[model samples]
Target: MVLKLRSDFFHSVLLDEEKCKGCTHCIRRCPVEAIRVKGGKAKIDEELCIDCGECIRTCPNHAKYAQTDSMDDTLQRFKYSIALPAPAFYPQFQPNISVGKLLDGLLKLGFHEVFEVARGAEILAEEIKKYLSLKNIPKPVISSACPAVVRLIEEKFPSLTGTLLPLDTPLGIAARIARMRAMEKGYRSEDIGVFFVTPCPAKVTEVRQSSDDVGRIDGAISISQVYSRIMNMLDELEEQKSLQFSSWKGIGWARSGGEQESLNEGEYVAVDGIHDVMSVFEKIEMGELSGILYCEAQACVGGCIGGVLAVQNPFLSKVNVQQLVKRYPEYHLLDDREGKELVREGVFRRRRPFQARDVLKLDTDYRKALEKYQVIEHILENLPGLDCGACGSPTCRALAEDVVREKAQEIDCPFLLREKMLELSREIFDLASKVPQTMNEERGKQTIESNQDSGTATGESGS
Candidate 1:
């Protein structure tokens, strides 16, 4: 496939060049190989990067960070701002606090209204279960909730593209519902902006997808940034509503198995963490996991709770999810009628298929690419073969590929430069040895004798 770079996409994950030490930490840790150190600083390839925040987690210098909308500034643009907090947002507060209190906290923090993304998760469950029952799709239908996972599939596992579920994610559904409710309140669509309180930069990238006319939310605020601010405000808030707005199944979305729990039928396989998702995706691609009906892959280890930007311990946050589910183990009336009407009205429209990225392709031309591949292979043969990050590439072969692309040179490899220096030193010694030993030993004495003879001849001429 000839993959095109998504120049239109906005990446919240940015590099502060002044702070980067160029330690090769991000390049080594990035799952998609999307990061490269160029000119003594780390740079992200927007097309290849999934915004998983791996670089943010790995950078010791704090050079890699996420840029999100300032909530204070975001509120000024709209008369009514709805805060759509992700399920991951729940665990950041004190565990004893009620879900209603959390929503109240949002209201206290300046939002006119607040909506649980979990409510959207519950609504999405019905649609996915329906799709699985009727469609003759490939097995192991992957979840699209995590934008990082969806982008990863598009870039690294194109063969499994058909396996991706067609449904929009919980946040997408929540945004739609939030806006609908706002419009019902007499707020103009343009006047009300929906903001997502997100745990990762991936959500920021997803909101930026609005440029393609597919975006649901207006902006995203970093969860870490929102957490401390909200926690400070929680003490002054009072619960103005009740937890009856959402169901226990929706709350389950904070963890790995939560999505499958919302479904009534079909065998389920749920995995979290980017590395684990990659392993499971590879199996699905090989048709090894065909018996499974659904595969929910969360980019973070404990689902959204494990986001790199999160301040809370992921395990502790997961405990909070379980506690919330145990305490609120009740479902709101199906509102089956509303869900059906939504389905009829295309409220939960499918997402556009992600275009596969040709990250592995070296060149656009067939013959030229073939020639470059061969050259890359030849360069690889001369490398040390250790996948060391010293030269800034992840592997020897990667460096060779970069060299072939003229992005780097063999001299960039310290080991290769050392070898060249040793060879030159040997050559110099070998050339010096060509001087006869007698001539070499008498060279200093001969020089002194010539000088003395010149002086004696000058004295005789003067006499």
Candidate 2:
């Protein structure tokens, strides 16, 4: 199998240079240290970025944003388009807005059909339970549902890649099922476009740069883009379609710990937020979390509801989801036979193996990398050890790494620059105070002549 590099992937989170103030806000907030302020502008390192949108959330100037597909452009591209709305999309609205009405609103938005990603989540839940039962598989399987979390593992915790559940995400599975259903209705595959109405930039990036299959999803549109249109259409509609198929368990996947709740059994631990996920991963690496069956990790704080592109308050959305959950049944539309058949066909399985990103490596050659590591340590020793972002890098250690990589100079640190300035001033003062040897000899001779004249004058006065 050919392993792909980080450069091969497409990142949806981007920096708007015009809006960026180079205030180091993004650099400080970025979980992976992917952002840096350079030349009075913020720059994202594509290799290091996981498209988690932490920078987007933290940027006070709104300089960071997700680049998603336009609904108009995507609809115009194909003869028929299907909207695959995520589970989190439902909670963005009021509780009075039924799931059926939300589906109807998407149809009014020019989508020929609307597929529920929650249904796909339900399918995945069943399959995951079956996978967990197998004795051959490893314990503590990690959920591959969140693209940002998966990418984080790829970039930061490569050893845990094997622990990731080798399954397609709910959105990916929904796209596949939606496209298949469209084809069954006599629509040509080329004429059909399946788009995910995503709440996060990571999903947009996943849709654009899917390693498993490029054709699974045509595009991803952010929730913020079509939120107003949906709200306006919701009130105008008189009749709602019976489009809701996902169960309460499926709908619960929008919030934190929802994936584990869907299983309803197992030693599962769900962790939300990228930093917290990292902490869990660290514990797993240290063998501190043994005997666990599965780990549900989400990059966003409140799962998908807290996505940077989401318009609703995450806490309010969580409450809305809970209300919606109470109204729906526990079981989803898919029966056990159909779910088993889909699993047998490998619809939920990942086609490509998760590849580790080599962004952490200092150099390609071992010897050179070791030398660079030593140099970075030496440079780090002179640094103030402050993680302040004033130096553009996220931490002093990062600045040292940058210096070793030749991307930055040691004087980039303000403290180091001040010390250098003071040393230069002292050197200049010493040079300026020294007189030339010839000038010193001439002054001495003049002083001696003056002394002799004064003595002769005193002797004449006495005579």
Candidate that scores best on lDDT: 2
- Regions of candidate 2 where Cα sits further than 4 Å from its true position: 1-7, 211-215, 238-241, 437-463
Cα lDDT tens digits, model 1, 76-177, are 888888898888888766678888888887877788888888888888888888888976888888898999999899889988777888878888888877
Per-residue lDDT of model 2, residues 1-463, tens digit only? 3466553567899889899999988898898998889999999988788999999899999999899999999999999999999999999999888888888888888999988999889888877887888886765899999989988998899988988999888887888778878888999888888999999999998887653342468889999887889987777654454677788888999999899988857798999999999999999988878789999999999999999889899999999999988988657457678777676766887865687877888998989999999999999999998888889999999999999888999999999999999999999999997665456776556556665877653322221
Best-matching candidate per TM-score: 2
Task: Tell me the lDDT of model 2 at 280.
Answer: 96
The lDDT, on a scale of 0 to 1, for candidate 2 is: 0.86
C-alpha lDDT score of every prediction, in listed order: 0.82, 0.86
Model 1, residue 5: distance off in Å is 8.2
Residue 73 lDDT in model 1? 94
Model 2 residue 55 distance off true place after TM-score fit, in angstroms? 0.7
Candidate 2 clashes between residue pairs 3 or more apart in a chain or in different chains: none
